[model samples]
Target chain A: MSDHKILQYPKSPYLKTSYYEDTAIQAFDTPFRKKCLVIGLLFWVCFPFVASSYVVHIANLSAIAAIGAMSLNLLIGNTGLLSLGHAGFMGAGAFTTAIMTVQFGLPIWIVIPASGIVGALLGLIAGLPSFQLKGIYLGLSTLAIHHIIKYGCSEYQYYGGFGYGIVLEAPSLGPLLLAGKTVWFFVLWISAFATALLIANLLRSKPGRAWSAIRDRDIAAEVSGIDIGFYKILAFVVSSSLISMQGSLYAYYTAVVSVEEYSFGLTVSYLAMIIVGGLGSVLGSFLGALLITALPYALIILAGLVDLSFAVKEHFSVIQTGVFGMVVILFLLLEPLGLVEIWRRVRCYFELWPFSYKPLTIIKR
Target chain B: MLLASIVVLAGIYALLGSGFVIIYKASRILNFAHAEIVMLAGYLAVSLAVAIPFSAASLLAVLCFCFVLGMSIYAILIRPLAGYSVLSAIILTVAVGVLLNAVGVFVWRGEMEVIPFGWRTYFSLPGNIRLSSIEFATLGIVTLFYACMGLFYRFTKIGQQMRATAENPLLAAQRGISIYRISGIAWGIGFAAAGLAAFLLGINYAISLQIGNIAVAAFVVALIGGLDSLLGTIPAAFIIAATEQLTITYANPRLGDAIPFIIMLMVLMFKPWGLLGTKEELDRV
Candidate 1:
């Protein structure tokens, strides 16, 4: 217990209770972390200025995913809930934005918050299964809910024989019609950054510790006087709201709200982001979003540069999927602690220079 | 009478559920890619049907191929992941499913293919109820497999060994039960069941990528029946099939996909252990 480094939540003067800061995310307040954050922020801010429009587009996509991934990390990585229907919330957000904006002529500012509310409502419904179910049952129930949501979305899409999806006019938050690449890039980056910070702060708070307590052991958490059910639902609501907000922004960015785009595949990618990055860490979520977002483009570059046979080039799409699956498998099999664990090891090695310890250092800590 | 629809639909779902049940019983790892593998085997059969003439012998060969494929998948990819968390392994299966889906799109290119199953006859009963020969055969095949599985688990040496391994892997290993062989057998049978369901599905309609999504409904049925209970899928499948069939008949057919899921959620809310799932499973997680 002496080794545990509790987070200092500035506003919450009531909580003197502390828990162990066991992951890279908890070390976020360190001096080295401040330096890294500054450097990372500077790089992202200057990134669009030097990069081409295509690169900017990729960054925009990564930024949206980062926000969504970080939100999901709040639920899955921190709260220890396995939700397979994250896309349901994402789709809900997008549709809320589209319906409010297109049908009621609402502004972007109003629609974003409305979408988050819708997402939180849906999350409450989805979170119901978690109260009575655990593990596989909970996962499947979420999946079923996701399918139900998708069914509703498709019905919306095909309603009145439209034969297609809803298309939105370009989003404008007042005088600015955010159609330009540079403008979209900055707008998306700011939203994602703010989301990351918001989640980080929440994770360092009392509710965060309560969520963690429930995650480590629900029975024990209940005995410790935490309202396990309330906190669990709260985790879902907060995470789902943020995720839906990302979805709404995505709709505005793409200017389209198609049900087909929000499928199980989309959910899988978000899960991949959190798992590959480090489930509970905000930085891991960001890293995962960037990696997964850039993965396809990287594969395309590799394919184009290599003088592969025409047949191989034609089948590159499936090959890329195989490569992606293999990478995830390797991570799960070899490094279950994820990239956050790898990052910790690297930092420790540098700090200890000549006396870097082995995996057993985890226990010694 | 919609009894025909219920019987045919539930039979297929029952087969699909067994695929989930067997692997879960053996390894305790939920294979999210179960349906995808099932879809792949169906595609394999369709491809073979094109190259070689369809016959009972050919069907057996295709199922055998799927069994081998399943064994290798477990041996090569999943076995190495035994050291990781159950959630992580399950996530890996999700990745595998995505990859398999990509392969389905790559190989078939989204076109619907039919396995020339060569069984097109339908037997009609009183009251306008009709059963396609393939559906009838599927019902028979599933029943036979379940009966055999029951006997195997109750009376055979390997069956007892499998039970031991599933109950306590570490203790079973010390007691001379081979986890490798039991897991292999479980995956093989599970894949075989999936292949049979896929084959029947292709014979009834056309095989398409959407088959995987429909097969996902099987998970609902299985969970409601009980994840670990081998025979529990029967009653759960019937309940779901009846509900879905009624929904299709009385309501907008579009809601058919949501019916089973709704039932699953309802069941989970009331009886989380399922109809026959052991009460202790709630604590295992």
Candidate 2:
């Protein structure tokens, strides 16, 4: 039965593995998979060139969101460590960018990595408590970290005399002024693509396997000689650093760094992205980001179609939040495996075609 | 005066934390929506107080509504989440919190609204400290609530059943006790306690959407007292309230919001099970 299923698809060069060399180990193993990658890349490349500035802006936001979501997925989904301080780390990166560019006039090259380092240090501090705390306790500690970061950011804003927030000029690379939505769409999406590649590669490596082991059962993993503490802390550091870098990019993209923007609500939205997209999957992170980022606009369109009252339209933010909450709840309750599972099922249906049901062998009585 | 403030704040936290502790004791799930419940109760109390002529009647109405709300929340959201991971239940609570907050803002506009439970009177103490009538009332109510809870658990058949379920759900079910109903009652009592505290808080200070943040501080209180131990909530609340007061007085006022969390982190690091909680609880999670 399984053999029949395997023969349904065209034979691919990378389908079989040799003794020393694994062809199936590559990211795009199948020809169809390679084709999907090319098409996706083409679409991403063409998006900003063809779309309106508003649409491009939304895409750029999704790109930044994708980076954060992927980083969070690395922690929550892969490493089995829940973090509520994602926005705190993102805020750290944003503040780092704000101070570095606006105050010291630092180059973008130095600023981005500086933000990551800051996040890494914060991650270390946050991860230190994870040795003793697990499950809900760890999540609570992260929530504390988030509140502390928010408090610190506000105090820093006060001391700097930037009552509102610090603003930055458009970044420059020699003659290239990285300003408009179109430029940002490329910069952000490319960064997101780079992050996705990095994550994909990491997941296939030893550390990734160790992470999965720890996530599944820490005690069993520890008994097997895996350094659970080191890997857990490493997960925090890597994930936080990636998210922090994305935060720096976001600061640049928005041209402002305000403490108000990085709220617990923002963290919840990123969490929604990872969970809704498909936890532990690279492509799911991006898809979730795009969907969540566009959700509010979609709600607005729906509201217009429904001919909602002007007063109802005024409360669009409320409706958006309610819808977001409902979506997260529905996803948690009905589709715990998330959109990726649904996608897989759909793909399987098409691949199987007429024989959608499981294949059966002939039985002679 | 500082001590008086600590006492009052401790009373407030104890009331809030007891509800948190009760729900955790019965269900083995942390109710993140308790904060929303607090906010909603405050709003509901304010609206009810306005609609009803008598203040006491309004309070009763609000408490009854919150009790039913808690039971329905358990039935609709939590009961369905039983088969899922504990994390799912926690996240579902968060989602519920968000939904409640949105609905609240939509109805109440997120603005601060004071509960018009009449004018306050200040009472002078021997040490040149003066406290409001509401503070005294809050303290009295908190004491009464805990006392009632203790009595109820010791004597009432339903409370005994709840205690049995909390101790061992399978055994309780084998004994023909409805664990679901017991859990619902726990939620109801928990919500009612938080609601009463919220109403008292609204009477003293204006209640806004931001007031829900108090639930976080209350969580720290609950943790310090131990998650499942009701007796620990009082001292935990007292400790947290004093620390918060001292920190605000001595350190930067901005640290006031972060102090409870910092303490929470410390408690989490040094004692994952909480100060008064059972050691086995740490391993269970």
The candidate scoring highest on TM-score is 2
Q: For model 2 chain B, where is the 10-residue window of minimal lDDT?
A: B276-285
Winner by lDDT:
2
**Model 2 per-residue lDDT tens digits across residues A1-365:** 99999889876653465733451345476677899989988997888889989888888899999999999999988988889889999999999999889889998989999999999999999898878777777888898898889898989998999988898999996688898898888888789989998888788788898999988888999999999999999999999999999999999999988999998889989988987888888888988998899999888778777877877878889999999999998998787777887787776677768875863332210
Over B33-143, each residue of candidate 2 has an lDDT whose tens digit, in order, gives 888889989998888888986888988988898899889999888998776656778878888989998888889888889988676899998889998888888788889
| Candidate 2 structure lDDT | 0.87
Error of 1 at A118 (Å): 1.2
Q: What is the lDDT of residue A207 in candidate 2?
A: 89
Q: What is the C-alpha RMSD of each candidate to the true structure, in Å?
A: 4.8, 4.0
Question: Considering only N, C-alpha and C atoms within 3 Å, which residue pairs clash in candidate 2?
Answer: none
| Real contacts retained, model 2 | 0.69
lDDT of candidate 1 over B1-285, digit per residue (tens): 479878888888888998888888889887789778877877877887777884566678778987997898889888887765567878888888877877777787766888776656879888888887777787888788789989999999988988887778899999988898899988888888888888878776777878886678888877888888888999988888888889888986778878888888778788988898877787766
